[model samples]
Target chain A: MIELKDVYFSYPSGAVLEGIDLTVKKGEYVGIMGHNGSGKTTLARLITGLLLPGKGYVRVNKIFTTDSERLLDIRRSTGMVFQDPDAQAIGETVEEDMVFGLENLGLPVPEIDTRIEKYLDLLGIRELRHRNIRTLSGGQKQLVNLAAVMVMEPECIILDEPVSMVDARCRKMILQHIARLNHEGTAIVHITHDPEELIRCHRLIVLSRCRVTNQGTPHEVFGQLLDEKKMDVPAPYAISRKLGLSPVLTIKALLEELCRSRSGN
Target chain B: MSIEIRQLTHIYDASTPWETIALDRIDLTISKGTVFGLVGGIGSGKSTLASLMAGLGTPAHGSITIDGEPPDPGRNVGILFQQPEDFFFEKTLFEDMASGLLHLGLTEEEVHKRIHSTLDLLGLDHQILDRSPFHLNRGTLRLAAFATVLTMRPGYLILDEPTASLDPKSRKRLVEVIKRISGDIAIIYISHRLQEVVAVSEYLAVLEQGKVAFTGTVPGYLDWATGQDAWEYLPVLNQVMYGLQRLGFDVDLNVACLEDAVEQIRLSLERT
Candidate 1:
């Protein structure tokens, strides 16, 4: 439901993204991979209407990001979840945080409460409704942020390295929730440096030196990761590729492929 | 010098309503020329333990000794906190790196020489020396922070999630440098990322709820964590091989990097 057509962006120091054209259809999971200073964050900001492109267009739900009149509507359709939970959280409690976003949408009080309950239940964090935001764990806070964003009912969610600082257990938990949301038909544009986080994505886009160097399924793009050296591939995938096995993203898939090969099938 | 912690316990804001026990009767030791990895979930007191080890604060209970001596902050130990850029204050990176060295009576030339050598080891260009630490990118800033700490030439170094927010290139660079300097200086590596921990550390400890849950070598820690149903934090390769064994695959799971894993898989396939 998001598109960037011939987008060119630059900073005062130098050029960032150039001649970029991309589209995210409804219910698609797009994993954006890039190194530091690789314009991944800028691309996400452009799609969410937080930063307008210097050239070309960034459209969300057919609304141009450059259009000030419909900027609010664009943001309402595509919510952004940042890396640090403490920075985005404005409320003192979990319920308050979720409700704060809903209130911003100017929804009725009862409707806001209903939305908060629905998302907390959906994400299975209903028990944390009254917990103090500061006391919550990093993963818990990130989940609260996701809940807050999802409570707004955005068609597409753009997450910018949301799990980079989270612990392994909590990272898995958050990824599971995101996977579920994507399965539920919410388009996701996930910007991450973690290879494990890229496993469940339907499509992988690798950005380097301000251009899209690789774009395809995880298998297709990561198969060349070793040779290209443009982006980092998951260890299992790299190992599988090196071993002449199928370039599988997850360990289970790699084992399945190995088992099939062992069985001569 | 070996750093030792005997029955260490610390409580935040003790004797108050908000008093919380951050650490509890934890005992550990880090010998010289050893890379000790501390793995745990968030708020498992990993940072608190690192602080105690660095002599940032006194333990509420028990004791810590550096080579059988009490801890002296900024003397024999250096700590690289997560987001260490927050610890920077000087206008320029050179000034920040030289902040702790001037007190040692080292000449400006000696400080500059040491900083350049350390930056080279860290794979950082010397061009960023004049720039503000805050102006540099996150990856460069992290290495710069490490430079500031390592220049102190502490006998012991405590790195708290050094690679947490770094990109792949930067993470690889840091990992290489950690491996390079690990032989001369004792390191207490604390991180939730098991891949880096398993790669860098010979000794691994798991912290669960402010207590030492498991402590041993890398392979032993993996087996213990797996047996304890805490394999969730193991690196993907370890988890995969372990899963294969659980599924009746005749494969070795002790491989480290992607290359070793590939060799192991190939050998397993050849046997089958």
Candidate 2:
């Protein structure tokens, strides 16, 4: 389980996250959403240990997130995929990048090979295994980034704005991959401003000034953001939310409802 | 002012073996004082087209014209990028709004007056004038970016994903602003959501595989969209409403908004 207790984060200017408390059971597919500058990214960093809380504690599985001896374990256990794919890549080629962390881990050659093969196929980037970084499109770059992290085999993945900058088709592809990961019992915490992305998760956590303002299933959080007329919630879902219906999150769900209603009639 | 492009193409990393085509032979036109929308899936060259319109990128093999002249950066074009705050480094909102006008040699007084009026137009109050640009919320920053652009008073305004990540009310306000201000300038709205484009656009273009796959009046593009698989990504409201038609449900085949669809359903029941 992951836990945050009375967490507060303050920058030099002002308090961003204040008096926040939350807990996530292992294998929970959680999503965090809010307007830009809402400190969604700050919360992600805090969980990843990229940034520390000014006050309070962040712990994973009963281990303190800030311990230096436990830091490596935290890093290994929690992987993050940021919005920009270009900023994340340090390898010249896709394959080399996927194995970069494994090589540093000093794993056995066979074990490293096994991990690399597993992630390459998992992210559907096997063809781009030897492709140059700069030549790939934004979607391809994102896929490679996901593959690189998957090769590390972390227990939890935290994605920040994963679909915001990418195109629609690529967004769908990446979102589907995340859904598949959650289904396989690997926890995913998607942090984004896109309403469509927010609705895909089983649960949502919303931050305002770095504090968790609302937390629950996507419907509940989206309900409040929307009742308050939050625009960042995917417009369609928010519109459905506005009209007082359990808005279908995907085309399949919408179609199923259409068919079922027709059959009922 | 209007925008016109013909045979426009862009090649990233030209003169290299690893070159990739971003735009290819794209032909488009935006009439004066009309909101023209560009929509497509990601990597559909929507942003590349926006760059060309904003003069941030050069078209490889095309003639581009905006307001009867070739597009030039820092000229008669004002752009609000997807992340508009990144482009701002001013200490205060007012200063940020005035920077471009000051660069253009406008008098300090003139810049100040325009900044004040534009800020009001965006619904931001005067107290925010002294507020740090970095400390503002996304909705405020999004509005501030528009305010800065309004200060320039460009003949053409290009907004890339202007409504993404905003709250519903903020989105509504932004859309209404676009509608109200579009008649004063040629508006180029680039986005992946076709529903939004359908709502505000007089004309529409869908870029696919670096080419302008469809371009015409909103109705014409809607017609094309209705016939293509591209409609699959439309909002669930549109899909459910349209799906009712496909399944022979009692309703018009194309209800984009839920309120209208609900009313239609009510009326249908009344007639029954």
Docking quality level of the chain pair in candidate 1: acceptable
Fraction of native Cα contacts reproduced by each candidate: 0.57, 0.35
DockQ of 1: 0.47
Q: Is the docking of candidate 2 incorrect, acceptable, medium or high quality?
A: acceptable
Candidate with top DockQ is: 1
User: Model 2, range B1-272, lDDT digits (tens) per residue?
Assistant: 46888899998768766566879998887887899988876556777788788888667898789867888766778788776766778788777777788999999999888888887787878788798887777777788887887788888888888876565556778888899988878889886556677788888888887998888987676567667845544544566566656656577655657677666554544444
lDDT, candidate 2, equals: 0.75
Clash count, candidate 1: 0
TM-score of each: 0.89, 0.86
| Model 2 chain A: worst 10 consecutive residues (lDDT sum) | A236-245
